[model samples]
Target: MSSSSAVKRLLNYAGEKKILLILASIFSFFSTVLMVVPFGSVYFVIRELLTNANDISAIPGDRLILCGWIALGALILGFICLYIGLFFSHFAAYQILYNIRVRLSKHLSTLPLGYFTKGSSGAIKKILDSNVEKIESFTAHQIPDLVSAFLMPLIMIMTMFILDWRLAIATVIPILIGYFIQAAVFSSDSGRKAMEDYQHSLEKMSASGVEYVRGMPAVKVFGMTMDTFLHFKSTIYDFRDWAVSYTKLCRRPYMIYLVMLTSILTFILPVGVFILSGQPDNQAFALTFLLFLTVAPSLSTPMFQLMYLGGELQKITEGNRRIDAILNEKPIAEPVHPKVASSYDVRFENVSFSYQEKGDQEYKLALKNVSFTAPQGKITALVGPSGGGKSTIASLIPRFWDIEEGKIAIGGVPIQAMATNHLMETVSFVFQEVHLFHDTIEENIRMGNRNPTRQDIISAAKLACCHDFITSLPDGYDTKIGEEGVFLSGGEAQRITIARAILKNAPIIILDEATAFADPENEANIQKGLNALIQNKTVITIAHRLSTIRHADQILVLQDGEMVERGTHSDLLALNGLYKKMWNAHLSSKDWGLQEREVHHHE
Candidate 1:
C-alpha cells in the first residue's frame, strides 16, 4: 500500500472514532497556543522589575503579583485542555483497536480454513497484536502530540521574531541547523535499513517466541534445552544484535541534535550583549532579551518531538502495511442464494486439489479425480497409508479448502452453495489430534451444541463413557482442564471430545482415528460410544486400525489419491490387493510381542 493509503486505511478502521481524534487535535492545538500566555507574563514581570532596577522601593509589588497569578492560571488551564485531549484520544484508540480485532476475527471465520493451513498463524498473529497495537500509539499519543509539536514551535518562533527580529533569527538559525542535522540522520538510507532490520528482528523474535511457547510440551517430553529450539534462540540473538546496532548507529546523531537544540542560549547570550552595547541603559530591550532566554529553552521539547514524530511516521506506515494486507485478503464468498441440503449423503465427483495452485511447479495434486458417495445412515471407511489422501479426503467433506476441478455436494447441493455456518452445523468431527480449551470440562463438552442444558451435556458424556471419570474428579463437570491434577489421560480427553460430538449430533460425522490414542480397554469403551454416535447418522470413518471398521457398510481403499478398491470387508480381502496387504500388516502389528535380547560383544 502507498504510505498515504496505509494511513487512510488505519483511520478508516476507526470509523466514527476518527472524529474523537480530530477533537483531540483541536484541543491540543489551542492548549499549545495558550502556552504563549506564560511567556508574555514572564516578559511583563521582568520588564516591571528591570524598569526600576536602580530603586527597589519604587517597584510595583501588586503588578508583579498579578503577572505571577495570570501566568500560573494559564499554565493550569493549558494542562486541563491537555487532559481533555488525552482522554478523548485514549478512548477512541482503545475502541478502534477493539473494533479492528472483532472485524478481523469475523472476517477470518468466513474465509476457507486454508488461509491458515500451514505456519502462517505467526504472521497473522503479528498483524493482529503488533500491527494493530502500533495504531494505538499513533492514534492516542502521537496524533495530539503532533498537532501541538508543529504549531507550538511556529507560535514560539513568531513570538521571538515579533519581540526582536535579530534575536529571533539568532535563535532560529541554530534550531534550523539542528533540525536539518536530525532530519539528515533520521532520513538516511543506512538508518532506514537498520530500522527495517530492527523491526524485522522484532517480528521474527515475537513469532518464534509464540511458536516456542506452543512447543513447550514437546520440548519437555524430549528433555530438550534452549539450544534445541535453534530458530527461536537465534531470533532472540538477532533481535538483540539489531537493536544494539541501530542504537549505536543513531547514538552520535541523537547526541548532536540534543546539543545543538539545547545551546540556543549560547547563541542568544552573545547576540543580546552586542545589541545591548548600542543602548546600555535600555531596560526595555534588556527585559525582552531576558524573556527570550527564559522562553527559548522550551523549544527543545517540541522540536525534539517533531523529529521523533518524523521517525515514528516511518514505523507506523510499515506496520500499517502488514495490517492492510490481511484486511484486503479476499474471503470465501458466501453464496448469494444459499442452498439447504435435504439429506446428509456426501458425494465428491471428479475432485482434484493441491495445497498450492496447480500452476506452481512445486505443487503436487493431493487428490486426483477422487469420486465417491458416502450414503446417508451408513458408515463409509477410508483406509490408506500415510499421506495417501485419507485426511485430505476427510478435510474436503467440510470444504476446508474449496475444490477447483469438480463438485463436492451434500444431498445434491454443492458445498460451495451452502453457507459456511450451515456446512459447519452439518458435519461433526472427532479428530485424531485432539484440542480441548483451558476451560471447564462442562464448557468443553458444551462446544458441541451452542446452548445445551446441563442434563444434555451430562447425557452426552455418559454416552461417550466419560461420565464416570468426570464425576470422580473433585469438581465433577466443572473441573478445569490444564489445571493441577486435572490433566487427563489421552484416552479420557479423546472420550470427552467424542461426548462433544455426540452432543452436537450433526447429521454427518467424520471420525479421523477417534480411538488412536486409546489403550485396549479405552479403545473398547470408545468403540461402544462410537456405536451410540453412528446410529442413524451418515458417518465417514478414517482408521489405521483395520479391525475398528471391520464391519463398516462399505470400505473404500485409497492409494496415491485414487479410489483403488470399493467393497465390503470380505470382497476387498478376496481381491487380495492393497486392502488385503494393509489388513495383513494391521493383524501382524496387533499380534507382535515385545522381547528383550542380551547383548554379547565379540571383540
Candidate 2:
C-alpha cells in the first residue's frame, strides 16, 4: 500500500480525536513562532551596544531591561503552549492505540482457528504489543514535535528576511545542503534495504526469545544446554550482526549531515563581511551578524527532529501493514438468512476438506469425500491412527472451517446456512488440549452457561466428577487455577473442561481424545462423566484408546484421511481388517507396558 494511504488509515483509527490533533498542530505552530522572539530581542540589544560603542549613557538601559523581560515571557508562553498541545496529542494517541488493538483483536476472533495455528504467536504478539506502541509514540510525542520543527523553520525564515535579507540567505544555504545529505541517507536503495533487514531481525529475535523460554522445560528434562540449541543462538547473533551493520552504513552520512549543520556560521560570517563592504554603515552589519549567530544554530534543531521522525515513520508504516493483513482476512461468511435445526442428527454428505496454509497453492487433503450419519441419542466413534482426519471431522461440525466440497448438516439444515450463534449452541467440544482461564474453578465451569446460577455450576461439577476435589481446596469452587492458588493435575483439569461441556449440555457433543492423558482410575471416573454427558445427545468421539469405544453403536476406522472400515467391535474383529489390526496393536502395546512395569517392580 502507498504510504499516504497507510497514514490516512492511521488517522481513521483516531476517530473523532483527529480534531484534537489539528488543534494541537495549531498550538504547536504558535509555540514555534515564539521561539524567534528571544533572538529578535537579542538582536536589538546587540545593535544598541554596537552603535553606542561602549558609552553606557548613550544606550537606553530601560529598553535593554524591557527586551530581556519580553524575551523571558515569550519563552515561558511558548513552553506553556507546547505542554497543552502535547496533552491533547497524547490523549488522542492512546485512544487511537486502543481502537487499533480492539480492531485487530475482534478481527482475529472472527478468523478460522487454522489461521492462528499457521502463524507464529510471538510474531503476532510483537505486532500487537511493540509495533502498536510505536504508533502511539509517533502520534503523541513525535507528531507535535514534528509540527513545531517544520513550522519553526518557516516562521524563522520570514522573520530573518525582514530583519536582514543578506543574513537570511546565508543562514539557509548550509541547512539546504544538510537536507540533501539527510535525504540521500534515507532515500537510497541500500538505506531502504538495511531498514527492512533491521525490522526482520527484530521480529526474528522476538520469536527466538519466546521459543527459547517455552522450550526450557524440554531442555531441562533432556539435560541440554543453550549452546546446543544452534537455531536459537544463531538467531541472536544474526540480529546483533544486522544492527551493527545498519549503524556502520549510516555513520558516514550522519556525520556529513551534522558537519553541514554546524558549519552554518562558517558560511554566514564571510557572507556578512562581504555584504557589509558594499554598505555605508557598519553598525547594521554588526546587528545582522549578531542576529545570524543567534538563530542559525537553533535552525538545526528542527532538522534533527525531522530526520529522527522520518526513520520512525518507516517503521510505523510497516506495523500498519501487518495489522492490515489480519483485518483483511476473510472470515467464514454467514448466510443472509439463517436456518434453525429442528432435530439433532448430524450428517456428513460426501464432505471433502483440505488443510491450506497461507501461501500454499494446493490444498492438502485431510478428509476426502467422508460420509457419515451420527444419529441422535447414539454413540458414534471414530477410531484412527494419528493424522487420520478424526479431529478435522469433529472441528467441521462446529464450522471451525468451511468444507471445500459437499455438505455437512444438522437436522436437515446445512451448517453453512445455520446462524453462528445457533450452531455454537447446538455443539459442545471437549478436546485433548484443555485451556482454563486463570480464574476461580467455579467461573471456568460456568463458561458453559453465561448466566448460570451457583447451583448450576455445582451440579455440573458433580456430574463431571470434579466437585469433590474442588471442595478439598482451600476456597472450594472459588479457588483460582493458575499461579495464585491450587494447581490441578492433568486429569483434574480435563475433568473441569468436561464439566464445562456438561454444563453447556448442547444437543451434539464431540470428544477428541477426552481421556487420553488420564490414568486408569481417572479414566474410569472420566468415562462415568462422559456417559452422563452423552445421554440423549448425538456423540461423535475420536478415540485413541480402542478399549473405551468397544460399546459404541458404530465405529469407523480412518487411514490417510479416508474411511477404510466400519463395524461394531465384534464385527470388526471378525472381519480381521484394518480395525482388527489396530485393536491387536493396542492390546500388544498395553501388555508390553504392563510387563515392563512388572519387571521394574521385581528389580
What lDDT does each candidate get?
A: 0.86, 0.86
| TM-score of every candidate | 0.90, 0.93
Query: Best TM-score goes to which candidate?
Result: 2
C-alpha lDDT of candidate 1 relative to the true structure: 0.86
RMSD (CA, Å), each prediction: 3.0, 3.0
lDDT of 1 by residue, 1-603 (tens): 444565576568778888887788888987898877888887887787778889999999998899889888988889899889998889888977988889888888877778787545777887788877887878788878888899998998998898899999989988888778767876677866776786678778888888888989998999977797899999989988997888888888788888989999999999999999988988788888888888899999999898888778778777776665666777877899999999999999999988887678899888899999999999999998887899988888888888879889999999989998899999999888889999999999999998999999999999999999999998999999988778988889889999999999999999998888778999888887888888999999998889988899999998888889999899999999999999999988987998788889999
Q: Estimate, for each residue in 1-603, the C-alpha lDDT of model 2 and write its tens digit.
A: 445665687679899888877877888887887867887788888889888977878999999999999999999999999998999889889988999999888878778877877778887888899989999988899888988878888888888888788788888887888788777877777877777777677777788789988899998898877788777888889888988988988888788888988898898888888877777487776677777787788878888887787778877877787778788889878899999999999999998888884368885889999998898888999998889989899989988888889899999999999988889999999988989999989889988989898999999989999889999998998888875647888889999999999999999999987898889889877888888898999999999989989999999999888998888999999998989999999998887743334334554
Span of ten consecutive residues with least summed lDDT in model 1: 1-10
Model 2 accuracy (lDDT, Cα): 0.86
- Pick out the ten consecutive residues of candidate 2 with the lowest summed lDDT: 593-602
Clashing residue pairs in candidate 1 are none
